[model samples]
Target: MFGFILRRLLSGVVLLFVISTLAYMLLYVGGGNIARRILGQQATAETVAQKTTELGLDRPLLVQYIDWLSHAVTGDFGTSWFTGEMVSSGITSRLGVTLSIVIGATVITAIVAVIIGVWAAVRGGWVDKVVQGVSILGFAIPGFLIALGLVTLFALNLKWFKPTGYVPLTESATGWLATVTLPIIALAIGGIAGVAQQVRGSVVDALQRDYVRTLRSRGLSFNRVVFKHVLRNAGGPALAVLAVQFVGLLGGAVIVERIFAIPGLGQVAVTATSQGDIPMVMGLVVAIAAMVVIINLLIDLLQGWLNPKVRLA
Candidate 1:
């Protein structure tokens, strides 16, 4: 298991390096005059040349990449061209706001998924049908549409919550939660439905396994057999999907961020792309790619632990 985990970690590091190198080359070597664009067209050629030298745009590609990588390793994520503020510090400052929403939404979605999944599996009949219908709807409906509908219903029509903007959770936890509540729900709906559908399918399959039948024959209660044994065994595949979903959700916050006007990494990424703030955009891209690779590695290690066959492989 330790060997398997170590191997996955190594692979994750390699993947992150590859992603970062590609981003660097595209932004710097691919005809993107980083400093020139940042300085705007109105700036004189002399000023542009000086600014490029200051920003080290004149440095060789290899030197620039090495410097960028070294700085990234040491936690210096460069400054935002638009705001002229340290990018790393800006991200750190907004970390609380983004994390609150992501973590809260993730937890709520997972809990809801588990409950609905287990209930649907155990109950079957009409309950299962309803769950299936909802999951289908979740898969079909776009997130932006959900956000718009939520704003119209709760904010415009009923006045139950604020329609736009974010409030710091530290300042007022209740207000922060209330303000971001709809966004969280909007984000969570698809996750909950997806997880529930996967869990229900896994549970159904696990319940009919030979080992499960044997456990039942051994006088184990139905609930014990299903909850303890089946849930854990089925978790192997279900967890893999869930991990992917979690990572995807963290990066895919762009749509949700835009609709809700939440200033997060996703929002920063979008703005950076629009203005061609290559460094900021590249930083976010690296962050996202690293996050995804790390999550996948963790999932592999978890699967290896849960299923010994995976460890051997």
Candidate 2:
């Protein structure tokens, strides 16, 4: 297990490096005349040249990449070209807001998906059809649409929540919950729809296994047999699917954040991309990539631990 975890960690590090390098190169090569963008459209060629040299854009690409990587390794992501603020500090300040929404959505997704999925599998009637319809709806409608509808219905018409705002948890737990409630629902609904389908399929297959019949014949109650044995075995795959969905939720937060006007990494990402902030963009990319790799590694280890066949093999 230790060896497996070690290997996964090393592989994740390598993947993050590759991701960061590619992102950096793409932004460096394709972001197009950063000095001109920084200096505005009216700047002369001489000013642009001077600005480029000052910003080290005249340096060899490899040298620039190395310097950026070295700085990143020490947690100095460098100052933003446009804002003149440390990129690391900028991200740190907003990290909590993003994490709050994503984490809350993940927990909600897990609970709702399991309950609905397990019930749909065990019952196998209209419940199954309902679950299928939900999955289709979730896949058909984009997340932005969902966010818009939610804001219109709950925030605008119903006046149950604010249309757009963020309150720090440090300020007031109630205010924070109120602010995140709609966004959390917006993120969780689609995630739940997808993961619930996976769980339903896994549970259905688990119910067909021979041991399930054996357990039933041994006078075990239906709930006990399903929960203690079947769900445990089925959960490994479902858990993996859920983990992947969590990553998707992070990406979708970009759109949701915009719709709701919540200040988060998503807003920063959009602004940085529009302004051609290479260092800021690279920092966001590397940070997101690292999170994905780490989450996947944790899921792999969890599956291995749950299924001895996986770890032993």
What are the clash counts of all predictions, listed in order? 0, 0
lDDT of 2 at 200: 94
Q: In model 2, what lDDT does residue 268 have?
A: 99
Candidate lDDT scores, in order, read: 0.81, 0.91
Model 2 segments beyond 4 Å from truth?
none
How far off is residue 144 in model 1, in Å? 0.9
Model 2: colliding residue pairs:
none
Model 2: per-residue Cα lDDT over 1-313, one tens digit each: 8878888899899999999998888888897899999999999999999999999999999999999999999999999999999999998898788989998999999999999999999999997998889877986788889999999999999999999999998899898888999999999999999889998999999999999999999999999999999988998989898898989999999998999999999999999999999988988988888779878987888889778777665
lDDT string for model 1 (1-313, tens) is: 6788788888888888898888878776665666678788888889989988988878888998898899898778788878887877767676566667767777787788888888899899999999999988986788778889999999889999988888886688788877889888887887787888998998988888999989999999999998889988887877777886777578656788888888877678778888877667767777677768876887777777678888888
Q: Quantify how close model 1 is to the true structure by its C-alpha RMSD in Å.
A: 2.2
Q: Candidate 1 at 298: error in angstroms? A: 4.4
